[model samples]
Target: MSQLDAIYQLHPKRYRDKIEEESNYASIENQKQAVLSIGSLGVAICSLIIFLIPYSTTIRGVIAALALPIVYFSFPYIAISVAAERRRKEMERVLPDALLLISTNIKSGTSINRAFLASSREEFGPLEDELRTTAIEISGGKSVQEALDNLRKRVNSGLFQDTLKVLSDAIESGGNTAELLESSAEDIRTSLELREEVKSSIRMYTIFIVMAAVFGAPILFSITVYMAETTTQMWSQTDLSGEASSFASGGSTGLSFEQPDVNTDFLVQFSILALTITNFFASLIISQISNGNMKEGAKYIPFTVSISVGLFLAVKTLLGSFL
Candidate 1:
C-alpha cells in the first residue's frame, strides 16, 4: 500500500473506536454518533497539545506527552459537563413557564392535547422545544401516549419526564386529565417557590459562617501571632546554639534539639489562607443545604476552597491595620 493508504488503514476510525470503548457504547441507539462526538473532542484537544509540544524542551516534551491523554479525556469531560449544565439551566427556566402555560390552558377549558399544542406555539424557549417535538410526533400519526413517552425519552429531563408520565397515566385511566395537570403544575410551582424561600433563609447561615471565619479566626490568629512574637523575641536574645547542644542526665533536664526560629510572618500567612478556605467551604455547603441540591453542591468544592483561601488572606492583609 502507498504511505497515505497505509496510514488510513492503520488508523481506521481510531479515535471513534477509542471513544466507543470508553463509553461501552451499547444498549442505547445513536451511541455510535455519541462515540463519534467523543472522538472529535479527544482529537481536538490532543492534536493541539501535540503540535505545541514540538517546540518545547525534552522535559517539557515529556510533560506534554504525559498530559496528552489527560487532555484527550478531559475534552469529552468538558463536553459532557457543558451539555449537562445547559440542560439543567434550560429545565429550571422552562419549568415555571410550562406550569403557567398549563394552568392558563386548563383554566380556559382546553383539552390537554390542544393545551400542549398551544404551549408549543408560545415562544418560551426549552419547554416550547419539547412540546413542539411531542406535538409534531402526535400530529404525525403517533398515539398520544406514545408521543408523550417519546418526548420524555428524547429530552431525558427529569421534571419534564415526570410531568408527562403523570399526564399520560391520568389520560390513559379515563380520569380527569385537566384536574391532574393543574394540580401537578401548582405542586411543581410550590416546590420552586419553597426552594427560593430556602435560599433566602440560607443567607443568614452564611452570615454565621462569616462570623466564625472572619471575626473568630482573626481573633484566634491574633492571639497565636502574639505568642509566636513572644517566642521569637526570647529566642533572638538567647544563646540558643550553646544551650541547644547541652543534654541533661536527669529526666527533667529539658535539653532537646535546637528549635528553629519562629517566623511569625509565615504563620500569619498560613492562618489567613486556612481560615479563608475554611469559611468559603462553609458557605458553599450552606448553599447546597439551602438549595436542596447536594449533588450539584459537590462540584463547587474546588471553587469554595480556592475562593475562601484567597479571600481570607486578601482581607486579612487589607485589614492588617485594624489588627
Candidate 2:
C-alpha cells in the first residue's frame, strides 16, 4: 500500500468516517498531516514563550509540557470544525431555494434525478455541488435512495439530513414528491423567519449582556484592582515598625496595625483571569442567543477577551497615572 494509505489505516474506522462526513478534506492523510503540522508549530511557539514567563522554572516547565499535547491536538480540530460550520451555514442558506427549484422542475415533468441536476446551479453553492454529485451517482446506476443517503452523509447538517430522509420516505411510499418538496421548502422558510424573529426579540438582551461583560465588568474589576494596589502601597509605606516596637514594649492602648497578607501581583493576575473567563462565557451565551449555536461563539472569543482585558489594563493604568 501507499504511504498515505498506511497512515490513514492507523486511524479507527469511525474517526476516518467522521472526518470525511464533517469536513471537505478530500484526503484523510492530507488532513492528518495538516493537523500534525499545525499542532507542532503551536507547541513550539508556546514552548519558547513559556520560558519567558515570570513563574518558577518548575511551573513554567509543567505548563509547557501540558500545553504541547493540548495545543497540538485541539487547534486543528477547532479549525476544521469552524470550516465545517461555515460550510453548513452556506448549505442551509441555499437549501430552501434548491428545494423550490427542484419542486418546480418536478412540476415540469422531469425525473427526480434530472430535477436535482436541473436545480444544481452556482447560486446554490455547496448544496448545488451535493445535488450534482447525487445526480451523477444516480445516472451511473446507483440506487436513488443510496445516492441520496451518500449525499446526506457528506453534509454536516441535521436539517439537510432530515429533509432528505423525509424525501426518501415519500419516494418509497409513492407520495406526491413535488408537493412535498414545495411544502418542505415553505416550512423551512417559515422556520428560518421565525428564528430570525426570535433573535430580533432578544436583541436588546444580547446587547445588555455583552455590554455588561465586556465593559461593566472590566471597569469594575479595574477599579477594584486599583484600589487594592493603592491599599497595598499605602500599607507598605506606613511605619508599622513603630506599632511593632510599642506593642513589643507593652505600651498603651491595645490597637495595633499591620499590613494584610495581600499579594498585589496575584490580585492583578486574578483580575485578568476573571475578565478572560467572563468574556469567554459571555461570548458563548451571546452566540447561543443570537445564532442558536454555542460553537459559533468561538469566533467572538478573541474579540471579547482582548477588549475586556485591554480595557481593564488601560483603565488601571489611567487611574495609576492620574490618581
The candidate maximizing TM-score is 2
Alpha carbon lDDT of each predicted model: 0.62, 0.83
TM-score of candidate 2 versus the correct structure, residues matched by position: 0.87
Number of the top candidate by lDDT? 2
Of candidate 2, the 10-residue stretch with the lowest lDDT total is: 20-29
Name the 10 consecutive residues with the lowest summed lDDT in model 1: 20-29
Q: Give the TM-score of candidate 1.
A: 0.57
Residues 1-323 of candidate 2: C-alpha lDDT, one tens digit per residue: 87757865775677656655545622133676666565677778768867766789899888877877787666666666667788888888889989999999999999989999999999887777789999999999998889989988777777788899999999989999999998888888887788789989999999999899999998999899899989988888999988778886896566777699788788788888899889999998998888877777877988999999999999999999999
Q: CA lDDT of 95 in candidate 2? A: 90
Q: What's the TM-score of each model vs. the native?
A: 0.57, 0.87
Candidate 2 segments whose C-alpha is farther than 4 A from its true place: 1-20, 24-29, 44-52, 243-250
